[model samples]
Target: MLYEGFESRESFDLLTVLKAFIRLLQKSPSSRIINVYGEMNEYDSDMKSWTKLFRDYSAKFELDKLMDQFYEEFTNTNIKISSAILGNDNNIQTIVEEADRIVHLAILPFNSSPKSKTMRILYGIVGEGMGRATRSKVTLEILLKEQHHVKVVVSNRAYKFLHDNFSKRFPSCDEASEGEAAIDIIKIEGLTMQYVNNVFDEKASVLHTMQRMPDMLNKNLDAYYKNLVSWMPQAVISDFDSFAYIFAKIHGLPILSIDNQHIVQRYVIPEEARESNPIAFYTYKCFVKAKLPRCNTIAVPPILRQSILDAKPLPVEHCEYFLVYQSSKSDTSLISVLQAFGEKCIIYELGREEKVDNLKFKDFSEHGFVDDLACAKGVFDNGGLSLMNEEVSLQRPFLSVPVENQYEQVLNAW
Candidate 1:
């Protein structure tokens, strides 16, 4: 039995884990998959929609009233979904006690620590950028392939993303399989940075998140403690997630930190490069040190899809058009800037769903973006480590606009 936690607010982070879990399930045909989640209100609007669909489908079929009949009708299918709201401590405890292993997303929780001997593995990720999530995906694939049971906990948009992908990847499973595992998805509140006109607004973001902390802590802590006590995990594998780092320390579990963020902390900067932005670099390094816990092992995973790794980069002059990636729908400034380049060169903008004359806008996609990037003349995006890594790997001319007050992005850009 396995309890997977996907408690992230960022969709990319959740997608990373979701893809890994789906691949794991597909490879391990005999494995039983159980997914657990929290209250519907905790999720963002998109995730709420999915939950509603699940509820509506259940209600329409009257599955609650006729579970036996429904099971009989869909007996040949491999996937089965059953949802319950944990309104009290008893319900939470019951689920925790039944699961043999836990897989958690890397965001840190506010609850106090507990002792446990269960084989628990965690994959934590930063909530702000997709780089951490991208790296975590590769790591999770490796972990699941090794057959280690884990509980994943994430929050924000990531939770919804992983939930949707899992549904799509494994629509059904074998009902008669004996070695079935339960996958639980627990959603909790995570900090999301506020933005003003596509630029990071640090003060407002902090205040906004701080305002919600009281209620988030009160509700999640109660459930967190109960679950930890019942399902004592043996180890944690974090990808720059603070909660898992703290939990590992409190419980004395061996933690392996795998992410590119650590490169700032552990890498040796050259003498000349260190002089470029001493204050910003020092401050950023300090912040990372404070957030991450000391781990038994620290590894920096590469952030690239198989397509990117396999393809050859075209020369700058030969490559046509500029590739742009931005997550916000409200930011029109970047569009205005790109328009200045004129209709002579095409601007391929990812993360925007529509197309506008000279600019070809497309929605954010892992495979699609890589294909575009492979043939682009230049790349323009916010200073996200994932994209930056790809830019460097492909040797593409790049321009990055780091979000104000997000020092990590600033440092990465530097």
Candidate 2:
């Protein structure tokens, strides 16, 4: 910017700088140009006097009002920005088709364009259990169906599950999106709980998290700066995932909390569901509130997988056997107790040895599992909110054995 007195000064070649700036703006619209040529890159209200030197400047010259006109155009919802203005059409076809342009914060693109109803979303999920993963899968598919570009940040089992599901279905955005869409799944470190004898071990879980904090921070930081910044999402969706929530806050982006866990903080619990253990209740409340206290929260019923949603469940009298699904591997006495019942029971425990009489151990497959659940007389589960909601949806009679000392699961069972 020039000093106010510079109009009368002959100390600098101001014309040369102004012309260079014009050339730079013609090539690319970036703030980087101002930074590159330091001192005097600015608009001068005094420059109107230069029209006296060039008589042609009066011919449709709106140089003095360029910014005002651009602002008006940018703010006008009716103006349509050309695809050419964004980039190579083939490379950013998805973005172009959606008409999403370069923007800062939540503002419309500076270029003249119609805004889109759909958005680019940064979605995060907790990797500890399959509950969050299963639910988020449905949400992601819905977003993709709506043609919203998404980038998922997760870790552990959730990362692998989502990666496998999305990779085969949609290739990278750099490639063509023939009739289908694509996504980028960026993995980061996440936390998990420790269980002993099918009970939550708070001490061990705390220690594990403390030890892994450094690795967690490093991976999240790398993903944040490298992939997340370039993606520049307009909104963030978190399913009990803190990393995504923090990212949304830092970038001043709108966030939508989509998870059942928010029921504790966002809803009124019945007296029966209130804390039997008060200390545990307040502690868990503090934790959940810390992640998302001010965001828009949508407390939804369990989002079931497509298979379960479409299944036709059978009655107990017509069904052949019951199903057993465990989220914890530390259930030492559960199989023995089931075996004593002397009725047929199907279970999933990957490395367990098989026994003949009453129990059947089967490898995990989505089709097989859904089929079993549909025909089962009942279910025995560790009270994962996702599967519990599935059982509820089917109206199947089941017994829930929630993990001890785990407030979320206890409330879920309640």
Candidate 3:
């Protein structure tokens, strides 16, 4: 069966395995696919922000929900999509007792904060693009090619959103109202908002999405080994999220670390601007341990590297300068530094969206980092693995401001 989880790498990895499982199913006449997930609606606050962005931004362009809509119309075959939430008291022992292959997929959320000095702008894009959207189609294609009897176990919320919307779009499939066509979707019984709240709420944001990560992974891994200990289908694929990394480590599952961006952008103050004291160094180390290790370890483009380098141009050009600070918390510090250099500054804090009296501190709820970054004269934020890597690749001359403790590592890396 194919299993899919959405959250972090551990949460979303089942989707990767499901992709392979689907291919195997096509070859086997009567094989089945089973997909599973935690609660979808009960997401980390960052996840909420991202979801809102997707819904709102896409709606404005009338292009949101295109992927699910497109997939339904493209395929015609027997498939069933079902879901069940895994409750608090739910026993993993009960589910995997049958001894079949189990796949898991999880999608984790990254918070929108410049405090994460190691996180680059590219990191966000890659995390959201592949970790969320691409996996859906990749898994679906795998199943169709494999022709396995597909069973998809998902959270009630995910199923409601994905399945219902799918059927509504493609009503002519073999089993339109929900018969098996292309792939089967089954919901796990106990996953609820309460459960997810408890799972991802350790921190105010979802970057702590890995809080319940260890336990959740151990539970799922144990169940998989107990039931299909020997057969161990093809491989377990996971992203760079720690849960995925841990799963691959503990179960000896071959890890497939998928990601697009490489570097995490930390700060983007113009050359004439002054630098402020960033966050602590230990925080930077924690990110590497908790976040970077989980990814497939991809590099960002080269352009960003050049952009960052260019931003800190030497020999003081004394050119008419504008200081645009994207980060809310760092603006005061940036201005202090710029004024020390005797440079003209225009500081823009991203809490509001419009131009206000010489200073711009707009609420960026309607605007995401990508939008903000595009408008930045020189971007300043955390150097996330994804952002830094992509910037380097793109050859953008951005600057990197390491957190207090992480300077050594960042310097060495740059």
lDDT per residue for candidate 3 within 1-414, as digits (tens), equals 212112222423433544555555446333333333232223233555546534533332221122233224313222222222333223454555322213321111112122322100000011221112223334443433443223233332344534553434332211212122333333322211111211212133334435544333334333332222221222433333343344345444465544322233333323222222244333444554555354435443322322333343322233333334331242336544555655343444334455443444444221233343433444343333444443443333456553333343243234
Question: What's the true lDDT of residue 370 in model 1?
Answer: 75
Give each model's whole-structure lDDT.
Answer: 0.55, 0.67, 0.34
Candidate No. with top lDDT: 2
Q: How do the predictions measure up, each by TM-score?
A: 0.63, 0.72, 0.35
Worst 10 residues of 2 by lDDT: 32-41
Find the 10 residues in a row with the least total lDDT in model 3: 117-126
Q: For candidate 2, lDDT tens digit of each residue in 10-107?
A: 22444345445554444544221111101111122233523332322222122222322342332323322211123323565565453443332123
Candidate 2, residue 172: Cα displacement in angstroms equals 1.9
Which candidate, 1 or 2, has the higher lDDT?
2
Candidate 1 vs candidate 2: the TM-score winner is 2
RMSD of each: 14.4, 13.6, 17.3
Ranking by TM-score: 2, 1, 3
